[model samples]
Structures are given as structure tokens and as C-alpha cells.
Target: MSSPRFAVAQLDEITPTPCPCGQARRAFKEPWNTLATVHLTDIHADSKAHYHQKMTEIYIVLEGEGHLEADGQIIPLKPMTTVMIRPGCVHRAVGKLKIINVPMPPFDPADEFEV
Candidate 1:
């Protein structure tokens, strides 16, 4: 027998964890999988700026109005806005927001650094 070619995640059943942005519900994560993982993050008003060493992240805003602070540059954002953050770029989302984040190479806590 062969393993299933796909995996499914019930995000609501997942526990939320404190992250730099706010709280996050990470799904579709596996140690053997090195491609990517997805997270549902709630952006807090005081989201902290951070960066990843090698992982690339794509942020898709699902709700709220705000801006993306990337290396001191402010990029306005709204619902449905998408931004691709590359490795080593310090970034953070401002204001109240709900977003879906896709992290390439999966999300590694050890790779995240506060800026």
C-alpha cells in the first residue's frame, strides 16, 4: 500500500500559539515535508518585526486594514492584499488583521529572528 498523496488539516481544531504577529494556527505541517506550511495568523496592533533566515513567506490578508512594515518601508495593505516576503527581510504587519501565511521550506522556530 502507498501513502496518501495529500494531507488535510482542520485548522479550527488546532491550538493557537503566540507568535510575533499575534496568535497563529499552523496547519499542514510535517517533519518529513520540506516544501511549505500554512498558518492562520491574527495580527496584533503591536506586532513585532521579525525575519527568517532561509524561509520565504507569502502573506495574504483576509481581513482588516493596515500596512506592512518591511525594513522601515511602509506598504499599505487591505483585504485581499498579498505580499511575498523573502528571507532576511525584516517585516511586520500593523493594525488589526487576519491573514493566511504560507511559509516555504516550512516554518522553523529556530530560523525566526526578532529585528
Candidate 2:
């Protein structure tokens, strides 16, 4: 067996679509324990404010700027910045922000965190 190199996946390759909360997500990730990415476009803070189980999230800003309301505090995230969200945390992304989401436990459609 052999290991493969990890390269930065271009944001242009992901087509944004409406998530369950009406936000757009461009999913990009290898089918392994390396990394998982979800590009979020035009996100609102309310999106992350909700709660999820068995999933820890890290939102990296690819473009634009916005305010993130997590842990009952308001934090501003600009380009080249990252925000970490632990599992079972109520959070959301707000404004015209493009975010690259990395999930440690990966994403399972059936295990999606809902309020």
C-alpha cells in the first residue's frame, strides 16, 4: 500500500448548493481519514448557532468577512482565518462569507446535527 499527497482543493471546483438550513456547501474531501472540506457561501450566523452531535467543525475563511456567534460570543472572521467548533456546540455562519469547513469526524448525512 502507498500514501497519497494532499493538495489544496480549489474553491472554484465546488458548486455551492443550499444546505438543510438554506445555505450553500461545496463539498470536497478524499474518502479517508485525511481531510474533509465543505465550502460555505453566503452564510448567516444562525447556521452555526445550532447544535450538532458527534461532529467537530473548523471553519476556515476562504473569502470575504463575517461575524461568528459561538459560545455566546461574537467573533469576526476574515479571509485566511479559522474558527474551531467542538462537537455539540451551537453555532452558525453569517453574512456573505465563503468558509472552508473541516470536520474531524467527517460528515455523515444521516448524522447531521439539527436543532
lDDT per residue as tens, model 2, 1-115:
5556655556665666766434555555556544555655556534644656777778878877777877678889899888888877777666677776777666665656556
lDDT of 1 by residue, 13-111 (tens): 789999999999999777667789999998878688899999999999999999999988999989999999999999988989999999998999999
Error of 1 at 55 (Å): 0.6
> What's the TM for model 1?
0.93
Worst 10 residues of 2 by lDDT: 20-29
Candidate 1, pairs of clashing residues: none
RMSD in order of candidates: 1.6, 3.3
Q: Candidate 1 clash total?
A: 0
**Candidate 2: lDDT over CA atoms?**
0.66
